[model samples]
Target: MRALVLRHDHASQPGLVGDRLIERGYDLTTLTVVPEERFHSPDVTFAFPSAAEWDLVVSLGAPWSVYDEETIGTWIAGELALLREARDLGVPVLGICFGAQALATAFGGSVEPAPFPELGWTDVQSDIPDLVSSGPWFQWHYDRCVLPPGAVEIARNVAGLQAFVAGRSLGVQFHPEITAPVLRAWLDLDGGTLCARLGIDPDELVSRTLAERPQALARTAELVDAFLDRIALPVG
Candidate 1:
């Protein structure tokens, strides 16, 4: 199988998700939306697939808000269009954090800045906790998604809905795909600002995350494996 990985920022790496996909024999085609060369101006001008070409699409987290289309321009529209196309084609999609907000917006739902931003290790409530575990799932987001129409709430926590599944698509609030390298990059860069906003110390969060990463990543890999297996199965 093949998968398309849509990444918005350099810090938000696919981590265990990519490793699991490779293990499952999925050839990944990664699209780094906000590359170093185009960091200042991320241009999103590409024809979205009609799903006859791809098996699955995985949209990763972004530092920017999904609703800030004015700054991002028509690229946001293009992404939303892609989400709609994927849904119509019945292609499985896995959206993480900002990507989840984008998916919600694309599917008639809305995204707004939360009353309180979620940052750092947080707990989550899930019917399938084993499929999606509770804390210490890495989180760094100011906005949250309202469930899109026809979506089933899969997980939640004090912060809000942690996960939801719609048809063959899944949207998750936490960063189950985070790795040590990715975390380090995020913490060294934009995390300080996010930390100050949350009244947290960046170094402290990084240390805590490093301690928790081993087990957290293990569980995350397991979850990715399960998700892919579920979607890869043939319909009878």
Candidate 2:
């Protein structure tokens, strides 16, 4: 099968999720929206491909908000349109963080600043443990999703909605694909300053991620398996 993995910026990669998808017999096509050189000025023209061409679509996280058109105006609308078309066509989507917010917006929901940014490993209350696991998943976001119409919220925590399902798509506010290197890359890109401002130790965060690597890999694999078996494949 073919999978289209949307990497929102230079830093965010497919990571463990992509690895599992490959193991499940998927050929991935990764598209990077914002190049590293253009990180300062992220308003770059990008044409999102049609969702019909891929067997599965995975939208990764981003540092920007879906509602912030001023920074991402060049491609956010196109991406939202693509996601909406995917939903209409019954294409399975796995949306993470910013991607989840975009998915929520595309499906008639809205994104807004959270009461406070969630910036570390956190636990969630899962309504459907078989599909959405309740655990300390890696999180790094400043916005929350107001679930779209017909969407079933599967999990949540003190922050807000954590995971929701609509049709053949699943959107999660945490980053299942996060790896130590990915975290470091994010930190290299002004994330360290953000961490400092938030009183989080960057080195400690990276070290903890390294320590959680094995368990995280297992959890990510289980989530992807559940999503494919219970959500994506049934309709796909």
Best by lDDT: 2
Whole-model lDDT, model 2: 0.92
What TM-score quantifies how close candidate 1 is to the native fold? 0.91
Provide the TM-score for each candidate, comma-separated. 0.91, 0.98
- Model 1, 52-159: lDDT tens digits are 578888899988888886556567787788888988877788899998888888888888887788888887888877677765688888888999998888898777
Report clash pairs, candidate 2: none
- lDDT tens digits, residues 1-236, model 2? 99999998999999999999999999999999999998878899999999999889999999898988898775999999999889877789999999999999999999988989899898899999767778779999989999999999999998899999988899999999999999999999989989999999999999889999998888899999999988886552
| Candidate 2, position 85, lDDT | 88
